[model samples]
Target: MNNPAAPPSLLPANRRIVLSGEDALRILREIEFLLMSLNNIGRHYYPDGDDDGADAERRAQYCAETTRFIDAQQATTRLALMRRILSAQFDTTLGDDEMDDIERAVAALPLWRVPGQ
Candidate 1:
């Protein structure tokens, strides 16, 4: 599995990528779908019942996975909103100060790891 702390090689610091509104919507939809799927899978594997200690480990694992997914979903949603606001209010290419602000905003978002990663 890739390290979650590592920056993506595809996006270098000096590179700037533009995402259209449609792209942002698609990303949001995909994240929602994945979250739904994660919930479904967790339910199938760990149905709610009396906590009999037998399933304690599995339940904890499921809970952790759910937390990660929810965190990622929230951060992604915030990012999409920020992108939309920036696009609507200013040029696609941001100046250094604007970029710094964006970087800070992104850094404030929760960092999440994928399940089984």
Candidate 2:
């Protein structure tokens, strides 16, 4: 016997939980807000270093902390609800590149902070 063909959304719909566009946008916005806050704080507390090495280290530290924060928050239903709120908040659709930018920003934050201190 031959297997029946599934609908287009069947694969994704079956495998993963569905999140509304508004939900995803809220999460993205929360991430953006957090990063912005960190940038503002870093600008004030973290000095503008003269050398590239010092700058790189500080950014790395920030990124590491941000990554940890995201991982910690991922387990909560509140994050999901907040993302749903953000979905209505944003006017534009978020692409993979945009999501990637968030990751890069997180990774680069350590450039300004001290490492393993």
Candidate 3:
């Protein structure tokens, strides 16, 4: 499996690759979809159906695997965003002071709380 800690290498070479607020919103949406898929798959594989012992065990393992993949995806996305944001400022069309201001703003923001706990 690919390491989620590693930044994606296929990112555009341009240092100032610009992203909009829309892009940030998209990232959240993508994460939600992946998480939902993982949960749905787990529930399907381990439905409270037949009482076969072997099937039960297989489903349990599958659920764990699905959860791991979801976690890894979230980790990878965060790392990727950090790299992108740092690089974005350097390459921005915005002036140096403007870019610095943005960096400060982002830094000042509190960590996001997942909805509904």
Candidate 4:
């Protein structure tokens, strides 16, 4: 696993990598696909049909932990990309109140991935 506090982008910020709108959208799509793939893989490994004994219980716990680890990695990558995008000033006219509301709404979200994605 990479450092939790450090991003894994190959391009350092000093390289002046400005994210276009399309780049940001593509990054979002990649995050969505990663989450779906993780969920599907976990189910494939620990399906309900396999849950009956102590070994099954241990596998279930391991699967849950793996899901959390993947989620955190995806979040770190996406958030780092987001920092680059927002730092470049994609849009600059919103009032402070609007920004605050947006922050609050995003903070309230339970999961970053869209449903059924």
lDDT top scorer: 1
- Go through the candidates in order and give each one's C-alpha lDDT: 0.58, 0.51, 0.57, 0.57
**Candidate 3 residue spans exceeding 4 A from truth:** 1-20, 48-56, 60-79, 82-117
What tens digits encode model 2's per-residue C-alpha lDDT throughout 1-117? 534343222222233455677666767777676677556545543667332545676768766766665566553455566655634333343334554322333443424457766
Prediction-by-prediction clash tally: 0, 20, 1, 0
Comparing candidate 1 with candidate 2, which one achieves the higher TM-score?
1
- What digit string (tens of lDDT, one per residue) describes model 3 on residues 43-117? 676576443544667867886787687586675676577566545544234443544334544544556689877
Q: Residue 62 CA error for candidate 1 (Å)?
A: 5.1
Q: How would you encode candidate 1's per-residue C-alpha lDDT over 1-117 as one tens digit per residue?
A: 533353222224334556678876766766668667776857755677434653677877777777786686675675566566544543334444545434534554566779778
Flag regions of model 2 displaced more than 4 Å: 1-17, 49-117
Task: Return the TM-score for candidate 3, rounded to 2 decimals.
Answer: 0.33
What value of lDDT does candidate 2 attain over all alpha carbons?
0.51
Give per-model TM-scores: 0.36, 0.31, 0.33, 0.39
| Candidate 3 least-lDDT 10 residues | 2-11
> Compared with the true structure, what per-residue lDDT tens digits does model 4 show for residues 5-95?
3222222333344667787787777667667766766666667745454386678776777768668767667657766665564332344
Give the CA lDDT, 0 to 100, for residue 41 in model 3. Answer: 68
Model 4, CA-based lDDT: 0.57
